[model samples]
Target chain A: MIENVTLDISGERFQVFYRLRCEAQDVEAFARHICVEQTIEFPAELIGDDDIRRHVMGQVVSLAPLDDHSWRVVISYAVEITGFSLTQTMNVIFGNVSLMPGVRVDRLEFPDSFLSRFKGPRFGLQGLRDLVGEKHQQLYCSALKPMGLSADQLAQQAYQLALGEFHFIKDDHGLADQPFAPFRERVSRCVEQVAKANQQTGGSSRYVVSLNSPAEQIVEDAIWAKEQGVGGLLVPPGIVGFDMMRRLADDDRIGLPILCHPSHLGSYVASPDNGLSFYALFGQLARLAGADVSIYPNFGGRFSFTRDQCLEIVKGCTDPMAILKPIVASPGGGMNFSNVQDMVDAYGKDIMFLIGGALHKGDATVPENCRAFKAQVAALLRR
Target chain B: MIENVTLDISGERFQVFYRLRCEAQDVEAFARHICVEQTIEFPAELIGDDDIRRHVMGQVVSLAPLDDHSWRVVISYAVEITGFSLTQTMNVIFGNVSLMPGVRVDRLEFPDSFLSRFKGPRFGLQGLRDLVGEKHQQLYCSALKPMGLSADQLAQQAYQLALGEFHFIKDDHGLADQPFAPFRERVSRCVEQVAKANQQTGGSSRYVVSLNSPAEQIVEDAIWAKEQGVGGLLVPPGIVGFDMMRRLADDDRIGLPILCHPSHLGSYVASPDNGLSFYALFGQLARLAGADVSIYPNFGGRFSFTRDQCLEIVKGCTDPMAILKPIVASPGGGMNFSNVQDMVDAYGKDIMFLIGGALHKGDATVPENCRAFKAQVAALLRR
Candidate 1:
């Protein structure tokens, strides 16, 4: 019989403990469910006569309350996994069987052995700040746009944004393998243009190109972007699996910071009191999954996230708990220069302010427009 | 200039049409947003100024309301594709920047020329019914366990259920690659044991295994499972990418009915007047993606979905649509033998009644238990 199993749920580096109680005789089976089952609710097909025969076999034994709102559950089950490898253990914890409802993960104890293997964040907050040469300053960020532009046109926009001394300039998530501006050509042109602007301005304006290829194409794209001398890669982990991001983060050859984009992930945490909380999903999950910068929608934008939710997301990104790495919270969507002061006030100096169309809403020359937006943001942040 | 783009929204499928007015200089960019971006409502970094500019360019020129509460919006845009192959057309529509936010897919016009290349579903409604030989009758479905059952143990239970002649025996969503009954071992053993029972009883009870492997492992798992003679594969398209299911459905070599599981998809349609409705997500989208059967939590379950939502899902599944396919609505969670008659009454004769733990809540052996469950369900249908 297995008495207990341990889990590490990362929330801003703080290791929260969860204990699962297993009433079943098979401890390994119980442990597997604890790791992967999203919730404790069971579907009708899973329970058989024998399952009901030992209905009380899998039940919570004890759950210790953590300092945070989270609790650690401990379960006891008669299952065994003496020779299971880490990968096997991970599969057991998160395998297909754990998708049953009402299967609460009771005991979540993080042993130093398990915690040691997980490299939380390779380049966290300070590392990113150092890379960009910004000390305790709010970073200005913008995105290159609409899919129809040629590589040169997109690069020109990157140059304009870089000339404003913007801290970060990422490709629109839509700018992947399109023939209009193929990824390689776009990355090369944008990186070169940004480099030129950075040389003239003596500022560190990193160009992050979109790496929106599928799994097979992901690493290839990352390696290609790195060869193109791009500062970072913008990845939509939601569309691509999180494991791909983890793999990219682990690769030293792909040494660029990853800007995590939230697309198609609204379904994961859109419901109230169900699925994961926004802070947990965009902030904690993104950071633990190795995102250096996590971008979510700003409140009063076209999206429905509230101001409180946005603030909580920012807190989840920066709050120091365990050895969790801090990530930059980049908020955009319907954001404008007029609200720079408000955004700065709300998110503090260590944030990334992302302004989109409002930067080029009117017919203004790209460089001058970017400079005006930059000046407004700088003046607001100085307050 | 592109005159109009049409979308097939599924209910009253042949009658359903969405026309968009595309005045945008970048018609493909506008179409991409309308199809994918606006639907998911991604954050600003993912969807940038260019996307919004193009979207603003395309207006709803004319909306022709169709039956079944569906409407078609017409949009005229610059640059229509001519003399392009299907792949080229897809590339033009979504290639470079498919993952961006707020990029609504203004149009998804599937011409038979392109649709002919796709296999759609190999074992759609009639094929699956033919395999089971249970004509004009609602099917009885149940899950294997919550979690923690070993391969031998799961096989024994599966054998007993097979003896009782369950139309469908599926893995609980939680039963992924867990250690207790590793995926390959569990699946192999369960399929063999069930096959043996089928041989004995001259019954056609089928086993549907959950193929929740990561993106890279998905195709391999599907192929492997099919080779192993598993009757069907359960796919939670939401957790995995939606395209994976489409690929599986298109695979003629693996002619298995794909059971769509709504595990982490609550966030997409959980809210009213916000995201897609339940019918749209579970019904139209799932069907369009090639789900022969769609599973959702029944009204009285622990989950918050209402009777109306369940009914809508069924309507979406069975209503006259393009290449009308029968999608068995398997409602579980807090459902049991006691409510078989009521369930049959509500959902009618074309439903798949799924009863989980309650079937095993008594001291009856697996065969006897399943027998009693089948008897009750049969009696209800007769009544």
Candidate 2:
């Protein structure tokens, strides 16, 4: 994903490929606008220091017009500028520039120095595969939904799904600390139920709760949930903010495979020519911030991620970065039982098929649906 | 801003007016999609409980077609669905719904029960005006910029600006805990300089620093900064998140005016037909999340908030919302001395004139520029 130009520049730097929407004549100026806007944020002429100008500011390393409406402008900034903080890294990447039009982050090239600062994916693709003992086989995931369900109802669904051998049973993002099914009660009952089902079936099914608690309690709850035997976390980077998700992922004690949910992040990828490229957000950012399974809307849903965009997200997840491991691309929005072959053909086996609402369809019950999904996918894997 | 229709709904409900872009014939279905999608993400037929349908689920209160492509659809949900927390409110408002296209959050209606749950702005418009003893005067604010400055250099700039009687001086959002000028050093020196200036000129120029730290350290840093004598907090909700900002504002001990910076929030407003309305993000969300001073790009800046959009933000800041206090509209990006009267004409006097880099221009020194800007604005105020 990062075909970075070997820039003859000083010190450690990170490269950001910006797709600048500007005319042919305006490329250099527009690229310069990014250089200043992202760094110093002051008029270049007014910044009197030489080192600040040369070392601290962003440098436009490459610029090429992509047709008439846009140009690919790659800019490099000093790694120290970020202070190695995840939020500040975000502030440098898209911060103030997000407010302006005609620019979207295309790709990022991070040096190991910058990349090492983040604990990218504690339990990546291989870890997830090993957890389910489906190293080479396709993995299946589903959400417990129709949210006003009590803890007992959700726990029953979790037990049924886990018993039927779902690799991952996650809470619907809507099921937060709502009064109907409080986070503590739901996680407690479901984790217990999942353990019971895994014991009975000898299946390595994991119960993942949405760590969608308020900022104050999230970290504590993550620790508590891990202690309470919850297998993983359904971290909604959008609702909780990506940095908070990163914090949860990076913490050593609460190590868990994060299923990165694309909740509020739709804004970042909604605009075609602004915010960030789909790969940059769902793929690169998610993997870089520590999503073992980066969940996004599949192509066919009312949620509109094109087939090409979905492919790009897959590419983003699997792209080789120094020590950052490859992650599972969990495509969810409108997955159905019949489309398993199509999805497998498109994304290959490096995906955790997230069949949500569709799993509740047909005359089959939840357990039957899960077993049926697994049977069909297992058959396909055998072939 | 909330024009609620008196509905015979059974619970304490909050309303969200969704702008649905769809074919006229498909309005009801698209509206129904929002009702299910926002709350119960499962199929309506599958939800077996009656109370969940009648109480917990989102109801389509009204739907009216807007032209050929868009419809204004209003939906109400149980207030308890949010759990009365800031982040959960955001989740319920724009969680998974944000991922889907053809719908944008137009306006929000909150009942007194829900609105009272939030602390709102600790120091709203009157509190900020009271900070400078300028209740009747149009307030002026500025940002310290060109980031790579040493603590001493930034402190000197802060001293000059405050000495010249600018009501507030804030750190540039770019000025985080970068090695060049660490957060603690910068905040300490700037706050000291501003205090010295206040002593010399009998002015109340508060030094505000950006509370843009990593999630783990943000709250601690906020409390530390306040205890270290920093007058106000510039919270980039896009970085620290709105909920985190609300937490800071709501905390009784570290009570400081919050200057909400729209750093990474541009994506939410960039797409014309997706994400959220300008007022919803900058205005309503800012106020509801407890931003005492909501800063945004003024029109005529390269930053693309139009004149109309800027006006809407001002309306959002000043709009009456139950017991929630109104906030000051800080019009920023590309503000120049010559445009003071023009900005005054448009946004009126309740504005915090956020003059950034332009203050460094012309024959005048920084202190001289500040004095001259105040003089001109004071004359306009007198007139």
Candidate 3:
């Protein structure tokens, strides 16, 4: 599958853009330190092998001062060292250096060799749109909430939401295999109920179950969810490994679109000067890992993502990568019906507006609330 | 079997100690917000069901002002909500609330019902000490380095390190299935060579391979590594899910002491007011997820762990948790031979000195350097 791998000393390399928030004098040194620390982690003088020194060692290609207090540096690592796996690529990019402070990964650029390695997002924006067979420009999604609800109660909730004709109805990230409503029981009941509602309304509503478990069990659960005629899967890539999600995305047997949730991953994007950018973590990496849809906290939400950061997240998701499909960005932390127009106005049509709690704040019943949400979204798209 | 689970209005609950870094006036309100956001995530007025509100909702047990600008809050959730799973436990504790800016998880306390769910560590401190069969107070571990080395070259290095009689020699976390040294070839060769060296020296030197891959492959690789006569496993719980490592530690067939490396988990501990404390993230959570030894950056290391923070991490690893055995703390990240005495004096006997690059920096050959390291440790411990 890897057609053209540059094996020479100047072999094609994947580039990582890092924003070093340090003293002006220490910028180059900081960039050089990342180069050394990322690869060999040993004194360059000690590395006798020239091949490893030149190829395996991370190469710093560009360094520019961002301002008085910060510098932007671009570092490159050999394509061969990544071994064409998401885990290794992440290791080469972040790995031990993630422990360091005042460094933020801005973005990443991969060569053809590295890009060809992953089958990112099996059902991205177009595929998902095709699946839905909907004419609306903006798709809407709602989450089933209150974790202690029994299978029947949650399924009934799902039926009400699906009847609203939202493109996707997903389980809350917290809804795992709990004793109150076990995974199999909850997933099957929700799938069946959603399907029955869809059949009645002649709408193609898909129910997504959260697959947050150990690796082996997640795969098993994914297969089971697919067998139950479930349309999609919600996986927190931070909880389960990204590559694990990639495996699920690439697996044809259970080829459901994966929706990535920001669970334990907030820390990575929270620190502006310490960790990775929201664009890189949520958008690029999620797509590379085969997530058809990625979710993050929207602006004016309970969470602390600014409008600019949220917009950047949308850019990362729908931006053109080499051959990878642009994934749909679903922004929902404290989303409500009142802000629905504002969200769509900012993110435009390709996005999925995930309105969770606001659906409950409606004056009408739950199913009636769904119909009202449909009218608002349809009206917004027409505008 | 769950012995006694209180199932009333005031039932047994697992406690999450959080530090809210906000204004004094917003202390209780902030704590209350976490209680609401962590569970249900919906407004109380919207939830008509009394049972769901009373039983499943997160309870704010204690709230106190820590300083003029911060507050200490202890929130508890029903044991039934956790569903006796690490994935869900993490979700309930952090989950959606992880996106909050001013909150930090200070510590955690589990009830009997929650504690009984996990079989902590199969091989804790004593179990690992038995495996080594050495009389040394502080165990020594070294990492095989400089990526892009062939499997034969790495195996030779492993053999040399084993001949040095270090307690354990581990593959660097970056060493995945690269073309230079495929995982199987590197693991099998290193295991064989280390065993041969141990046979010659009459030492019980263990070769720990880094299993940083997808879930299914990691388990399969672990079983195969065990069959190849590997003595231990090194897992990055951050890259691979924490529960995945727990599954390996609990698996009886491939029973080996698990060493946890902090790879992509730095941001969680880096920010003072945004994410989790070093103690809670590295110490308590790692042990709860079944790590026999947890590795983090030392105080004076290349990384930015303060001396106090490092000590807290140690306490977290070895402190008493219900029925869970105390795991050894392996403090690494730019550790050298010069700091061995200081490290031991600070950490006492129940620690492992993971000296990697320093082993190569010695005047003598690596094998001679190993013996010198042994003499230094033995002499220091006798004092």
Candidate 4:
């Protein structure tokens, strides 16, 4: 009888242990129910009472309680599942429990056989730092936005921001295949402008175009962006399925780091007790789904998320799991140059400081404004 | 200049009319900025200053403010369009606004060119009532279980509940494709069992299987279920795209009323002033997305949705919009026979009262329990 469940909680991984203290007569039945209920939502009658009794799968190896009341329990069942994907494993663990009210999931554990094939993060902390040429400093990030712009106009903004030496510039999540600016034309122009800027500044500022095309267009867009020399992509995992992210990350030809945008995803993690923890959703899940950078609304922004929530998100991104990925926490919305020092102090050097609108609002010319914003970011890191 | 920006604000269509309140000096610039910002996200320089100036074309017809803060402003402009589809139209209105902070959407007025093709709901309120053979009575609903059930076991449960004559029996959202109980087998068994029970009792106990399959699989699943004589389907619009629901609703061959599940969708309407309003999301959008029934967590249930929020959802469903559809608001989670009277008084006849878990715990067997539950609902509706 296995009784423990192990889950990778957002901030840190913990080996959670549990002991199911049930009536002696119901102990074995309870153990079997947990084993099946954790992974699949199949009813007890479906598997037959006799078969459940035979399983006798009930021993707790570890139990960890999350900030939420739910405890992550790791239990080993005698049943063998072969050739199933990680998603299948996840479905097996908590598919049924998700439906039951008050049944909180703490963590999940995989045997070495399943874990070996599970690619955590392709280009992690050091890998991303090496790609961006930022070794122990916070990266500066911005978004090219206000959608109705033409391809040429979007490119110019990208060029200005890149030349100004913003480490990362991504398309606003709203910038999809709109008639005003088709995706290909927009990506081509933006990438070209960024390349020219890189040539002039000797800075490795990367433009991450939003890849919000349908499933069929996802691979094509990624491949096309790589061909056009775009550095990365901004993907909304909530809109495009999680599997799409995995496919993009696995594509060696499309080697650009994937920045996850949490646009329509707030519903899943918005509740304090229900849904998922912000860190688990944006950090662990995003990382596991293969995000090199995860962008969320900064605290004190228009969004309702608090400062502590933002910190927890950062912790989830940087904290150690089975694999350590330096997930650049790009928090945007109402961020400004004045707040750079405070952001640095709050998130430390291992973060991507994202600011938008404010950089373009001042009377300063584009290049001057860009340079000023970059300077402020650099100054904050020095502090 | 087009004055009206048509929007599908979570399924509630609003034709926004707003006057260009910018100064004469800034009107053209503002118009161009709005276009570029809403459509392309291009900077001013990238577009030739003259081209940008020329693109600021608008002819104001009339402007009026609604009872809401929103104003109805009409303008006409030669807007460059990339594609024209239901999906694209939705994108054109709300896509860019999603990025903008504090930009309250006004109203939407659509030209016949766009509006003519949209068939709001095929079998809305009256159609659903006719099918169920109840003109002015609340429907009783319940979910099957936590999952892990075998086909036979699920069928047995369905038989027991259907024999009891529950108006609607649905698959739990968590019951997706799994090895433990495959979707097709489970659907086939449950449908057959329910049909047998219906034959015996001559009751309208419809079985709504969860149809949260991928987009491609959606049509096939619906068609197959229809062929097998299943009554309806359960769709999670949040998990599956909203467009998919529209597609399913548009299909005549697979004509079945859809029950919209708020599975991974709470985040969008969870915050008070952040995402779409709850009524807007669960009621209007779900109905627009072609749901005959919409399910939300009842207040005092396992979820945190408030009583006011629940009522708003009901109002959104039954409200007389451009086209009135009878959207049956089905609230579940921890509801029991004891609360049937309160549920009826709160939601009224145009509702689907959902209760689960509690039925199985009663001393009365499945059939007797279901009969008593129905009697309770019937007694409440008589008032």
lDDT of 4 at A126: 68
RMSD versus native structure for model 1: 8.6
DockQ metric, candidate 2: 0.50
Top-DockQ candidate index: 3
Model 1 has a clash total of 98
Candidate 1 lands at a TM-score of 0.74
Give the better candidate number (1 or 3) by DockQ.
3
Q: What is the DockQ ranking, best to worst?
A: 3, 2, 1, 4
lDDT of 1 by residue, A149-256 (tens): 667878988998998888889887656664456668888899999999999999999999877664335677888888878888887765555545655776888888
Pairs of residues clashing in candidate 2 = A121-A290
lDDT of 2 by residue, A186-241 (tens): 99999999999999998888999987787788899999999999889998777677
If you assessed candidate 1 against the hidden native complex, which CAPRI class would it receive? incorrect
Candidate number that wins on DockQ, 3 or 4: 3
Q: C-alpha displacement of B154 in model 3, angstroms?
A: 1.1
* TM-score of every candidate: 0.74, 0.96, 0.96, 0.70
Question: Docking quality tier of candidate 3?
Answer: medium
Candidates 3 and 4, the one with greater TM-score: 3
lDDT of 4 at A44: 35
Off by over 4 Å in 1: A1-122, A133-136, A176-205, A211-230, A241-256, A267-275, A300-304, A321-323, A361-364, A379-383, B1-58, B61-119, B251-255, B320-326
User: What TM value does model 2 have?
Assistant: 0.96
